[model samples]
Target: MDWLNYHHLLYFWVVAHEGSVSRASEVMHVTPATVSIQIRELEKALGVRLFRKAGRGLVLTEMGEAVYRYASEIFAMGRELIDMVRGRPLGQPLLFRVGIKDVMPKVVAYKLIEPTLNMPEQVRLVCREGDFSGLVADLAVHRLDVVLSDTPLDPNLKVRAFSHLLGESEVVILGERKLAQRLKENFPDSLDRAPWLLPTDNNVLRRSLDLWFADHNFHPVIRGEFEDSAMLKIAGKAGVGVFAVAAAIRSEVETMYGVELIGKIPSIKERFYAISAERKLKHPGVVAISEAARKRLQ
Candidate 1:
């Protein structure tokens, strides 16, 4: 098959709009036969009839209508590209798709993304949360613009990604008011023999908390184990037991869950990261998030 020619398509486009070859030729500074032959060549290349007789004028065939739609968009985008490069605004909303690891706290995720959502320019945000490795894979293939994770990108994964350390903060033990008041004093010693709601064993926070407890020789009765941070906080509000969480959103947790802060463990820190295909951030939303987190978190 011959390669498609835009000249042929352009001639067909002009003839379609003008409704006849003679009218198109007059405007195009070509003979009617020249315009007709080019339209025939375009139809042959595409393997579809572009037009049919309707009274004295020409009307697009079904296949021609489909081609016309695509041609129209192609030309429109070309114009838009030119205008954009020339410093003209197209007013098109930017799309930002972010993937969050399932282990990440929703509140923390929201804090990280809030700045991007509040941008002056119009933007559409799409958030997906699930497996960390899978999310990293999506980012590698450009399926995701960025990814937020409680842990850094795994070094073992073959996928290429750069992890930007947003910040790290100490972990805080929280409980319902009644329980917190009882265990508030004597701090570390008070936590000994206390009823505790713990994160699932596999969790990074749980591992850190385990080490911290072992170091301090403070052992608590593990009442319940939760994989979901929000559920753990809910159980904390129900007085199930004290649970540990990152201290970055201290005020938000207090206000939203109405839980009491038992104490802050400065030694135990949880790091947050933004993973991307590029080392230097390019997406406007991602840049906003990384910059704002540097100032707001930690």
Candidate 2:
């Protein structure tokens, strides 16, 4: 076999892991054309077809699957080597790529790590805010050094509870003035009458809320559904309907919009875990950030 190009191998690995050229392109911050070309070049050099088109996307062929298995191991070893060299005092500053769920307010995340960002030693802190599933998947693939998320890690991945108590709060924000007044007048009883803006039915938070409602026999009039907190907040502010949100995030919601929590429901709190590949714990940079975030957030 000809000497393999590391960059091409990386592109191939990402495409194989992501299972789609478009998704790999997003993670690599490159164009789909670039990824396709590189993968083609890699296949040409190896004298084997690595992928086959399936509908609009490419699926790894038998040879591609075999190569990907080895490629993953090779990349993992390369990362270990880089980490070992970077750990030396005279070597380059360690690069720590962390991922956080989009649900987490960026401002709060920044505030938590403000101190470490100014450290004298050259440390590269790259933070990517994304959905929980995508972030977790990336962490499992060694694309992220660490991930701060409310969701549980996959069975294949290793996770530790950095923050034992993930404190969250839920309150209904009434959009209409008449509805707000009625809610206030009726107090807790009015909760069942107002139209509610809820997270998606599959969201853990939403599930918790449903359970609470079931236990209390309080059925809310759900008017809208949102997958993103930002959108829920906006809808509430626009008087479209009532919305539920974390209490700690109330300040953020109030600052940007004119909305008030109607009645306090039981706070929805969960455990937040610091997730990473188990082998990644050997890296000093990964350990440092995990400890730092655990201390700050927990």
Per lDDT, the best of the predicted structures is 1
How far out, in Å, is residue 262 in model 2? Answer: 3.2
Worst 10 residues of 2 by lDDT: 158-167
The positional error of residue 235 in candidate 1, measured at the CA in angstroms, is 0.6
The alpha-carbon lDDT assigned to residue 8 of candidate 2 equals 91
Could you list the CA RMSD of all candidates, in the order they appear?
Answer: 14.9, 6.3
Evaluate residue 201 in candidate 1 and report its C-alpha lDDT on the 0 to 100 scale: 78
Best by TM-score: 1
Question: TM-score of model 1 relative to the true fold?
Answer: 0.70
Q: In model 2, what are the clashing residue pairs, if there are any?
A: none
lDDT for model 2 comes to 0.67
Model 1 Cα lDDT, one tens digit per residue, 1-298: 5577988987886676556899889768899999989998888888889899999888888888778767655654544355347532467678788999887888899999999879998888999988887787667545688999888887866445789999988888888999999889989789998999887876788888889889989888999988888898898888989888778898898888889898989998888999987667767888999999987678
Relative to the true structure, how large is the alpha-carbon lDDT of every model?
0.83, 0.67
